[model samples]
Target: MLLFISYVILLLVDGTKTDETNTETDLALDKPASSSSHIIHPPQAVNDGNTGTTWGSNSCFAVQLADYDPWWQMDLQVKVKVTKVKVTARSECCPERLHDFSIDVYQEQPSNSAPKVCYFYSGSVSNPGETVTVTCSRPVTGRFVRISGKNKLNPEDVLQMCDVQVFGVAISTHFDSCASLVQYKQQHSTKTPLKTISEGIDNTAACAAACERSESCTGFSIRHLPATVCELLQGEISPSLQADVTWDSYVYQGCFSVCE
Candidate 1:
């Protein structure tokens, strides 16, 4: 019947539209990303898909001059849930040079804001020319991923990378309460505990709730007086704070709002 033909055509058109919508989303997730830096040797070698082991004089390797802070970055071009980052080090020589580096993911370039530190390598890597992969604690939404730190071998902070690969897909924003703020304290603050604002709080979760509800509170340090007690802080968190204290500190993002 004519009616049946018309219904079939309508269904076919709807199906085609659905397919096109899905294709668009897929392309958005997998679109080609880009990478760049202030300086590199044999330019464009960092993310060119070529792997190199030897460093000096190799056209396939990326090397920065000793004049600036060493850094190499990958730009995903769009904000996406970053799942993992991998770095390939040059082989057969200077393996010790890769120590004391950091892998970070940022909503934008590092110049724009303080990044979420995904991983930090402080110890020496025993294997020469090995590929180091760091899986994010959770999928972090960010457009830029950077690898930076000093080249222990060079005082001027020269750096190098053979390959940098980032893998992720477009997704919603990720909140990581599990990411603890680095250890910090106020310079004049005593190592002794601040007066507890809330006693018998039960746990850090209760302490965090108090901070979230308070407008002036920037961070909270929780200690179990055998029962949890919360000490809310007024000012910013200091990373260089040296104190002999046992309680753990949880900092709110608002503490760093001024810097951003």
Candidate 2:
């Protein structure tokens, strides 16, 4: 399995799609969860390798997001202002038991009596080659998040969660003056094309402006790059702010209105 060490939605343009193939930029997303490398307050449960409740499938999945819940979870941590959340089911992780799943957003940790649920997606894992993903409610907060499930494996020892992911860029950025933001990755590289060897911009506004002017850019990363260089990123829009909205209310709802 790919050691998605970072786990954050680093992003992949995926090209494009149609009826025969569905290729649209993944969609909007909320904040990302904290990776093991930077766990502030570790979850109540984790395994031997600090992967307690959140164990890396140790494999690559090819399923979609809508396929597995109560079986696998996707945690994220980022530095952007997010508005939506998307999860995909790959062929590798959370197989078989992923028919329908649920997501719960929590302002604070869900008590052991009822672990706070964030966003859940379910009902369809048959995307085959597509990225089985779904959205969440009004968007929640926090720089760190944990996605957990209850039914990822059956007695047969089948595993799900081969390839899981989250997408969404910061809505805006506030550069710290002539800083250059650099994009780093754990699973892959950034999607936005860089230019001039990744130079520094005057301020956050200038950074956003640089992104807006780029013909291929769908969005920009305000201060994602390293501090040594005030980088202005161009590509997908991302989120950096935080929220506490929950997806429990619409565990069984989805449609155009959900965009609200």
Candidate 3:
């Protein structure tokens, strides 16, 4: 009887450790990536699951010379609560180029606006092909993650990375049903509504369903000012759209059929 009890306790402890280990998922694998500029390799090469240090076609992502404060960014498509970020330095060339950089997280698509800094590396990488991991000081939530060069050694300091990884848990939202059907944006538009539904809407999910059912609807805006107000929009949704603290917007991302 005592042996059986000991076995059960061991299993319980092992299961708990497994659950904690699986909490963080890699959120930046093969996601849409972009950068300031590249010479031979593009930004997508860094997150292609290849850790090769060779500065070739499928190995490294390199920025052009004279590109001061160059940056590489990844779009996770959905909002994530970022925990940590990992970057691998190139081994064949100057590993010191990866020095003095900051990892930033943004709730919206990054532009000229400032972003929340998750971690900053103030020193140069000591070893080639070394993987450096930076843990956020606090819980940071955003859809976009960026790594930018800071305090460059020279004006022409170029940023080269072999691999980049982001680890986090996705934050669930009220519009999760339409998440696979549309692209969620944190901003709203000012254009006149193609149609408006101020009644029967309880939350953003219901508002998204209403827009999905309309063939002419290109996007939507939902706000809860004591009551839910949904506005179906027409035409393209641009980043220049207006931002409100109370409003959440989404753009139709095209599907096989309207969301059921």
Candidate 4:
């Protein structure tokens, strides 16, 4: 009986290993990609399965300006159970810019909802053409994966990636969430704060729920810096809506009658 139990345990271990190997396919290969902004090298270059990073080789993708947060995103074309993400640093120069980057997964497009944090790398790349693999603490389910630069080294920094890859298994059934469909515009705020709640609301999700409950609420703004601030807004977006990096305004996309 002891020998039989050992054999069964061995079989189970082998089966688990085989299942993991089968699901290790790179889902982001040759997939469509978008960036906050790009200069010469387009965002598509990162997912072309090429790691070459010579100057002017077009083997990497780079953001246009040195913004506080510059991001590059990939559309898997289908929902995936993302296990890990890998990013190759540019070989030619400026590999340190990849430091303090984060990988985020979104059920909907990035503009549509806030993303869940998959992994955050706090260190800089040590070698040229070094590929950093960030394993998610747990598998994250999403169709869109984004990598954003946090600019820990400098106040403003551009993001340059030689190649980006996502490893996961695609799921057939779709994941649905009403809150995920809510649209948000970053660096934007309404002229007047319809209502401001400094306490109770801690995150964007909670702030959004407050707006949905209000009859006159058209949108809302939430900022997380000095403290969590939720501001409810009314009326349509017009010229009065000014650009403010401190706030991110969200509008209901009418996904459901209520978000909560």
Best by lDDT: 3
Ranking by TM-score: 3, 4, 1, 2
How high a TM-score does candidate 1 get? 0.47
The list of candidate 2 runs beyond 4 A from truth reads 1-95, 104-118, 122-130, 157-159, 169-260
Q: Residues 1-260, candidate 3: write the lDDT tens digits.
A: 00110001111011111255565446788889999989788789999887788786377987888788689999886566788898999887788888989899987788755598898889999798899998998767787999998866776578888999888665433223333434344467788898989999988778876765553465688888877899988656655367677777776553222111
Model 2 lDDT, residue 121, Cα? 60
What TM-score would every model get versus the actual structure?
0.47, 0.35, 0.59, 0.57
Tell me which residue pairs clash in candidate 1.
53-91
**What is the C-alpha lDDT profile of model 1 across 1-260, one tens digit per residue?**
00110001111011111354463222122223333334435435666655666655352343444434556666555455566667767677655556677777788666787788777777655577778877877666566777776444555334655666666553211112222333333222232433456555887667765654443355567666555667766444445234535566655441111111
Kindly indicate the candidate among 1 and 4 with the higher TM-score.
4
CA error at residue 15 for candidate 2, angstroms: 18
lDDT for model 3 comes to 0.73
For each of the candidates, the C-alpha root-mean-square deviation to the true structure, in angstroms, is 20.9, 15.8, 15.5, 19.0
Write the number of the candidate with greater lDDT, choosing between 2 and 3: 3
Alpha-carbon lDDT, every model: 0.52, 0.33, 0.73, 0.70
lDDT tens digits, residue span 1-260, model 2: 11111112223222122345654432222212222221123222221122111124332322233433323323332222233444434443333434445544332333322433445664546653234455555454322334444454444322233333334432211221222333322222133435422455645445545543432343333333343122333333233212222100000010111111
* Order of candidate numbers by lDDT, starting with the best: 3, 4, 1, 2
Clashing pairs in 3: none
